[model samples]
Target: MKWPLSKKMETSLLACAIHKGEKLTNYCTDHNHLCCSKCVELNHRRCLQVTPLPLAATGKSTDFKNLSVSTENALSQLKYYETYQKDRMKSLKVSYKEHESLIVDGLRLEIMSFLLQCETSTVNRTHEHMQYTVIDMREKIKYLLADFEKSTIKEKKEELNLKQAPLKVVTNSCIRLHYELFHLHVAIPKVLDKPELSFIASTKCLENIQQSDIFIKENFSNKVFTVNGKSVHNVKMPSDSFTCDILAVCALPNGQVLVADRFNVKVKLLNQLYRVVSHLDVKQKQLGMCLITPSEVAVAGHDEVQFITVSHSQLAKGRKLKLQYRCCGIAHHQGDLYICSPTALYKFTLSGKLVCRLFEDTSADYTVWKCAVSPTGDRLYISSWYKHKLLTLARDGTLLATYTDPALLSPHGLHVTPAGQVLVCGWLSSTVLQVGWEGQSKLATLATMEDGVRWPRSVCYSSTTSSIIVGQWEDDTILVFRVE
Candidate 1:
């Protein structure tokens, strides 16, 4: 059947998009698509109510004016939406700038506040030092004057005859005192104004304070501990096949303990009596664990750190932080995470942001094995497993001291008690030693091979139960030392 086609219609309408050089002649009512003969044969062969364009439009009541008005209204609405989106983009830019400025200002204020605190502390210490110096000087002067007054003329002449050695000694002492006082007076103002100098001075002062504290604790505090009792608890689960190699132990405030089972790739939670209550299986082997909060803990895996929560004695896995470097040991201090690679130690935020690399020793692979922070968060203790040494670092990564003892062989685990006593276990020697707070010397030998501490891998002190929990390698049982 031949249909009359107008040339004007052919010139005005577009060709079929799918079939090149073919006009859209038929309409498919079912699919609501304009189709050419080839499109109908290939794509819409079963579409119902297919009609030619002229037949479809022949008897329809047309409304050209209303359709044109509706088209104009739709275009206007689209343009208005475009304009509104552009305006929203501008507003977002403005808000971003404002937030940036606020963040920068807040950082500046924080720095200023820290500086002010440092200045005030430095000034107060300087004043106290000056006062002590003046008092000492006056006391020495008074003693010298009294000695002269009490001496007879014959004694004075005899002393003068003896080359006046005592007088010369007194004179030199006074000169030295005067010089020290003068140096302090000249150095205080410069240190207060300079940030770097102030920080260094503050660190030195903190060290001195720590040393003094250690001295007092050793001499006056009488902190003596006798092993009240020892109990061994097995943490092997029934679903485990291999001998449990417990690598790390963490104690919470509520007397619960979390132990990382390296052989089974699980973190087990223990009740107050040190019995396994619940456990969470992880994908990777966990090497270390530390308490992030009273009810939260972080487990250090091979390539990431996983956070877990404990509620009502049940264990639940939380978020995971993926990292580029391997995480062997983990410690938390003041919302900052101290992660240990085999040869380096890094500081990171809780949200997976890297802060800085605090320390690194690439001489050996297991040189930087495990870490622990002091209760005050000013000192960091790292165990060098291969070297049989312990490294003490400041908050800013300064190596304060390195401690080595004959009893401490292949130190693996480190923990600081609430009273600031450091406890470290020797993996090779099968011994646990109590190190001083300053990390200068070993205070006491806590346990030995005879005490059944074999290859102790981790150690933690629980203030809630007043016990020392020790995790061992190739041992199914953990040792708990009750101390008074």
Candidate 2:
């Protein structure tokens, strides 16, 4: 009795049915089948030529390899889309909560105005209306975001999994979608539940959406900077005898600027025209300054951080945060304060509680002279005046990169723009250079000595007028460059 062939062995043999005892060695491409050479010769002599089985198998293997690569790319894209959606959801919640707070604060201001007018009945009605309106608006947004998560976002995710080409087609769609959502979030507060304003907001949102779409099509190129004009404004006060030493500059949301006058021991506010409109005497010499709110600023003094508020073009002293370390430079991100001593950088809460020592450089007395946080709050930059270096750090105090340039020497001030460009000024070089977001390379020389940037001590960017403000050492005037 013949030993039964194993199923695997029989499959490997792959004998042709029509050709008895003949192994299949050729593939008929036209008919798409495997057959013995004898069978091909007998049945397909006039037909298209047959290929060897190995050659046909090689071609099929190549096709499968191409398919595998495509699958991997599609999977990678889907993973990215998943992460983007999750982040967008988190941002949505944060933005809505912030807008809600703004609405409450705005209503309170309105109530105060009503009280001043002595309209008791109107105040009561307005207060009650505001409470009801805020509740209604919050509920609307809550439901809207819930519906969006349950419907639009979820449906898109499912579609991405089901179809691969569509994922590629809409890979950049999130940018436009984010712009639309952000525009709506901004417009909601301006609307105040008014129908006419809502219509206007919708129109403006459409325009922004269109612009975002155009931007996406262009592959989000870097913005080109051109100097549109330049001007100088003297920040020296009539009461001060010493020349101004503006060590740091902070730009507010309402087109106003605040400069830390180290020599005069004052924090001076500049209006839209770059003229000093108001000043607050901080007893000790001030160093770095940062915007705490749209109407408030925190100036770092010798050993304390002084908080000042701006109202109706006037400056008023507020609370002060006393630090254990000398406060030479200060920056704010989210709810945390980054205060820099000459040799160390510390993170503190608004109430003066120390969070942690973020960084320290004891090599020199002024190794960490000034600090600034990026808009996203992920990266922190510190200017080392003595070392002539810019150190970038992660939020957790991990050193990311150290940047040095010939155009930048004795870097005294660090300012991260809303667009995430890092602007650093060299005190000794009298130059202002824009560094990349990672603080790894210098992107451009924004201003030089020829551009009237003399002994630049601090740099700030005002988005409202598209201008760069440079504060100088021992100079009564600050240089402002309007750029596009």
Candidate 3:
């Protein structure tokens, strides 16, 4: 379990951490000294020689000769955590792009609505003015007509003996004619606006889909990329729907596909027709395996995972059993789920019963992002997101062999093909790796960056066609490699 960094090597990498009074300086200029000249004299009076930090950093002068298991584990943990965060950012980018269209559509509608309201206000004002003018004209006409009725035409004739006053009366017939043809005094709303809109739908919330491009900075699959490739199927989703980061993929016997959506905390089921017939939602910190079944699901929690029914109204509440510490992956064997962690993989039954517990070496810095059981269910292959190698462990936690070659860059997502080929994903560099049993032989290639397979998650083989179904994590697509 311990790394083989020699004492000589350890000493070469060591640098001094100096402390004086209450101050601490890391890798300072002075060798193993506590502080400045004054503090060194004060704190190192009882010790041996005090020198500059550069001297301690040198291979010959350092006090420590080797790195501990704990130190290596801490380093591995930090590296994977950074990688995980980076992947999240990539996912955010995809999500932002998906919302662009929706934003445009919503803005257009809002402008039209505003303009419609302005036209409606104009029409109301014009109608009010016309009504007042009509009312005033009618009142004047009525008064004149009444005055004419009170005095006869003869009286008017006598009063106007010197000058005949022409009789004038406003009639209903005149008013009717005026009302029949009227000019608009106020602007009527004719512009397109909210009120004029025949149909208007409220905008919905935007959903984002992104895949973080986090992997090893260096890559080495250039030579074997072609032989490993398969046909790509970018299983498309809706632009408006929320997208899930595909961390894991497994094919069912009926051609149904099971996906581990690490971010959305759900496991989805897709039939051969690509229909999502069933789904399970688990409310846990599922950075790795947010898995699913027909009626229930097993999800990874921080320290432990929960086995819960999919029918639960709330996701986190139905987690039937609290699992081991820091659960990362789930493997279904016979009647139990193997809970994977850095230090251990535990097996538990459906009713929250503890069936067995498998422990790995505590000293080894192993980070298991995904685990897969062999077809026979006797072997377990674990993929490391940070380590330089992959591990083959027995069901009872025995180390079968290690796969550490120069070809892989950040191994992740393990799967055992029905034909017994061990499949691994090269995270940073976009490659699918294959190895024979016992890590004795390489399967030439599976899929690589040159073949447009980047950051693949897992690979499944179909017996019907002898094709490899690869889940490309970063691209949010599936590439199927047919056996040629």
- Cα error, candidate 2, residue 42 (Å): 37
User: In model 2, how large is the Cα lDDT of residue 425?
Assistant: 93
lDDT order, best first, reads 1, 2, 3
Cα-based lDDT for every prediction: 0.74, 0.73, 0.50
In model 3, the worst 10-residue window by lDDT is 201-210
Candidate 1 matches the true fold with a TM-score of 0.57
- List, residue by residue over 391-476, the lDDT tens digit for candidate 1: 99998999999999888899998887755678999999999888876788877888999999999999998866778999999989
Error (Å) of candidate 1 at residue 136 is 78
What lDDT score is found at residue 185 in candidate 3? 7
lDDT of 2 by residue, 1-484 (tens): 1234344433334556467778777767676556788988888777676877656555241232343333333333333444544443444445455555565566556655644454444446788776666566556755765565456545555544454443334444644455444534344344434433333333334444454435332321134356889999988889987999988898886678889888888888888887888887778888878988889888888888888889999999999877788988899987999999899999999999999998988987899898999765768999999899999999899999999888889998788876556889998898988877778887688899998888998899886566898999999999989986
List residue ranges in candidate 3 displaced over 4 A: 1-229, 239-243, 273-281, 285-319, 363-366
**Each candidate's TM vs. the true structure?**
0.57, 0.58, 0.46
Largest lDDT belongs to which candidate? 1
RMSD in order of candidates: 33.5, 20.1, 34.0
Candidate 1, residue 6: the lDDT equals 40
Top TM-score prediction, candidate number? 2
What's the true lDDT of residue 473 in model 3?
A: 56
